[model samples]
Target: MMPLSIYFLAPSLDLACFLAKLYICCCIKYVVVLRSYSLCLFVFLLQPVEKLKKMDLSYSEHLIQIPNLCGAINLESINLQGCISLVQIPSCFKNLDKLELLDLSDCENLKDGMENLPLNIRELKLCRTAIEVLPSSVRFLLGLLDLDMSGCNKLKDGIENLPSNLKELRLCGTAIQVVPSSIGCLMGLSHLDLYNCEKLESLPKSIWTLKSLEWLDLSNCPNLIELEDCTSSSLRYLKISGCTGLRSIIALPPSLTCLDANNCTSLEEISSWWTPTVQDYDPQVQHQNNKSEGEIYNFEQCLKLGHDTCINVIEDGARRRILSALDVYLYLYLFLSLRKI
Candidate 1:
């Protein structure tokens, strides 16, 4: 059997001819071109790599382009992470319909030609890239489930064009100023990360309408002021630490079990119903049903929290504790009664 994996450690000018001879084998399944730091390597394969499944060119800092992979019909993953000199993707990249994962993290010079990504791609990582605006074509990637654009300082475009099928999105440390109203279209999104986005001033009312959303991080967004009229039915966790400009929180999701609002110095008004409602203890009902199970709350360093809000929070805690004690007493009493009978 012939070798199916190819490794190029120091590709020279003759490497193209070497690859041309190797391509005739037609069964190459993996290619790794690592750390070619001094050469502007441009690989243009002479024939189709019909069985190629994985391509890894990570840390090839001097690499500027990749081969046209139009005939790599079975290719599933491409790892271009840390290929900092790569300026654009090949136009033929859109033809790889079977491609599922593409990582472009730390490709600091990649700024354009992203308008035609594969339609069936599932996960795309563009963290710390030089992209200023996402191509409108991104919305058409209906099969995409995860997208990470974290640390993209130049990204300030409205995200209404994002694919609606995304389940997780990371836009942390970006310069975005507003989350557009069209964010409601991402009905399937479960995790949304916008941590440390300093220019962010507000969220659209539609954001609270995401029924599948479970985790939301808005930490360190100092320009954000208020959160009003929330009505989420599936949100489970929320973090808003270091938001010094936040002054009021009007409402939270009914299913929320964890909330972290630490260091929100300007926060004064917490919604009257910020804490889950305590219901009358019914011995027949399980103790877990008395209050939010496994609930966690953090209000540290919030010096401006209103007196009424503080009382409300304290009262809720006290009620839950009392209910817990009652449940234990009832269980013990029932045990004794059964023994006596």
Candidate 2:
């Protein structure tokens, strides 16, 4: 074989001119590859910056990963949402102290949450990823506020000892049967959305003590049997729709403004907090006031309260009734006004 440099230096007009220069550059000391992997050859490096910030790589399907993001120590937000081919993150991700938001949602190839992350990370989203376990090191992220891990079907059990300062946590559509007891310590938690968690059977009793919680969504949790009576002073909205296994709902806190309990097929009991006088009332009042109560409680398709399918109504003088999502409100208001009789 002829020498490689002599073959390339045989200058044709367009092609040979570029190849000869590449050969000379390769011959020099420019390429500093440590362990040249025969499979793929690309040394991607970030341009040096005084203060790099905000990398929004959303919907980049082919981008596998970024190497050693710690090189840019001032990076604040790294949005890698819907990066389908991304398998793993760089090892030095934890060194970036200013990283506040890290969105890795819809990265299907990621198996587990990386072992270490920036301690100041405020918002971490892993929705629809293949994460099987949340690494124990997550406790050290003291500044974390929002953590959204919805649609991680592989996570049968998530992490414990989450940051106490966390505000919002969304764990919708996972296989987890129970939430970690350590989560009860998140006193500052404002929004806890567990939508469509079909396997969740119960919640930690300590959840009721979350004084700062505002919105709690447990919609479509068919296996959820009950909720601890909520005492949160800040709780405003609650959703328990499609929870067929729920046997009863305890008396709600005074602060609760909205409650959605639709499609609770097996709900056999309900708490009594309707009457201002705290006296028992009748369900017949629902039909009497149906015309005026449309805005408050519309019972367009409610199974008649006297029907055999009506299992049991709010635990009192009223007979049991298997009402759908809409009709629950009708009976509530009707019974409340019945106290006037």
Candidate 3:
């Protein structure tokens, strides 16, 4: 009853519609697969990209080694503080030429004989480490601005050359007996902390050249005998405590705001010659426990005795004891200030 042409056309129409729906479905599936692949690639790439921004693995219990760090070329800062088990920093650290800050504070077991660090590093902290004697190559860190080597007790020598751009340098709790005169070369230095350097006897006269210095801490330097002809127009804060042998502090700069000489026993008298408009003069002077008759000169009377006659005719033995006590108090104050920072 139906025409053959109609019948054939009906079958063709249905087949055409079915084929179009199948093609569309395949295209949608292909698109979905492609988008899923793109997302996976994005996630993989984003992981490393995110890591480049900041890396603070300090005290991370499981992070023992820094193996993956080699690929973090864009890393600018790395904080490894309190990483107790991290015994070694990868020598591949030189590969991170882009790194600007590196904090290895309290890495007690990290003693891999690292004498030289990368030159490009701007800030380096080696607090509470056992590395002794910074390599001569340390001068190559021309970009360094801040360096902390506090509590490195075995560090005895080899600090002749430091970077000229250095702004802050701390050598606290070290056994450094002598500081090289070359330290004066760092004209940009603003803060220098040499607290608890017990063996240091004399500072180079060249130290007077630090015109940009603002703060200087020479606390607990038991053997330090004198600070001769030192002048710093920019110096504002000075601490010279516990220096048992410190006989005199000469030519204080006019810009000083705080001068702490709390326990300098050997310091017979503050120089009356170079007067400055100081904001705070904490002469925390305390008389020795065992005072001798001649050494027990009244404080007000001693002030009028003129610089040359103060402490005159006092037995050398008694003078030594008083001087030692004064030095101890002075250094104690200095140590406290350094700790505050």
Candidate 4:
């Protein structure tokens, strides 16, 4: 056989070129494979973005407008809280069939031009906005349970045709002078907050129909003078503080656990049938309308003084002792009279 070195030298350059081309081809194939793998991985990770069901864009200064969020068919909640620059909610929002919660609290620039929210929304907060009126389309929110519109200073018009299924409604800090009688239609309402509505003078007689109402706050409604016809049997908490014009409380329900009338100086009389457990009874203050010295009487003390005297009595340890003796005498007299009969 010929020597191995002699045969190897004859085809050395040809073999080198062939080997170089083969190595280059392998390097190109590896680069292609890596690029394809990276692209596939990226696509896999981004697939779930389409499945997003909840979004919160609060305090994001760059978010000046709401995009077409209707594509998110399964979206259940959207919170844009404190997005002060947001001026309006897109009209397409009505297309969100599954939306349940929509919070736009403190969106001060959101004006009255926006209209028609989705009917499926169960909770909504639009506090501290410029909204002046609610559109008639609001009646379409059949499933709404909680609606808060507090601090909408420009809101002077009354809400018409609210949903009957509403459970909690807050209209505090508005300029509304009257609440619509249509509010009586909300049979399921349990909590109503109308605090600081200074211009509100009277409540509709229909308010007596809220049989399911448990809490009612009418504090700081200075213009409110009469509640003779409005009474709710289910109300457990009632606050009428700062109602300086109110002179009487009539037809008070016995179910009340808390009654706050601390600053209502014009209240000259409390009915015999309605007596609340006393928490703080201060006697130094005088009545607002009359210069006569006023007194604070608790449930037990009121019974001893009788309805007429209770109005003049004040809270003092000495006065309480005297009232107790009077009560004993009255009871003894009643007992003797029954025996003689």
> Model 2: residues >4 Å from true position, as ranges?
1-43, 231-233, 272-341
Q: Give the residue spans of candidate 3 off by over 4 A.
A: 1-51, 60-64, 113-116, 275-341
Kindly report which residue pairs in candidate 2 clash with one another.
Answer: 262-325, 310-322, 312-320, 312-321, 313-320
Alpha-carbon lDDT, every model = 0.77, 0.62, 0.60, 0.62
What digit string (tens of lDDT, one per residue) describes model 1 on residues 87-111?
8877888999999999999999987
RMSD of 1: 6.7
The true-versus-predicted C-alpha distance at residue 10 of model 4, in Å, is: 67
RMSD of each: 6.7, 11.5, 19.2, 18.5
lDDT of 3 at 73: 65
- By TM-score, the better pick of 3 and 4 is 4
Off by over 4 Å in 1: 1-47, 274-293, 306-311, 314-341
- Best of the two (2, 3) by TM-score: 2
Clashes (candidate 1)? 0
Q: Pick the candidate with the highest TM-score.
A: 1
- TM-score for candidate 1, residues paired by index: 0.79
- Estimate, for each residue in 1-341, the C-alpha lDDT of model 2 and write its tens digit: 32322211111223224434554544311211111112121223333232456665566566665656555666787777777777776677778888898889899887753766778889999899998877767777789999998999887754575677899998899888988778779988989999999999988877877767868889889889877665433455678777777777665544444556667666655454423221222234323223222221111223221233222222321311212122554645655454455
Candidate 3 TM-score, true structure as reference: 0.64
Global local distance difference test of model 3:
0.60
TM-score of each: 0.79, 0.69, 0.64, 0.66
Question: How would you encode candidate 3's per-residue C-alpha lDDT over 207-304 as one tens digit per residue?
Answer: 77787787888988879977776544456567776776777766555344445554666776545333222222223312312332332222232222
Candidate number that wins on TM-score, 2 or 4: 2
* Segments of candidate 4 deviating more than 4 angstroms: 1-49, 271-341
lDDT of 4 by residue, 1-341 (tens): 22211111121234334324544443211110000101111111111123445666565434556656555666677777777777788776788888899888898988753455888899999988888888777777889999998988888784766777999999998888888899889989999999998998888877767878867889888888777644335565678877777766665653444466657766766543432222211122111112313222243312222455343223222233222234443534543453354
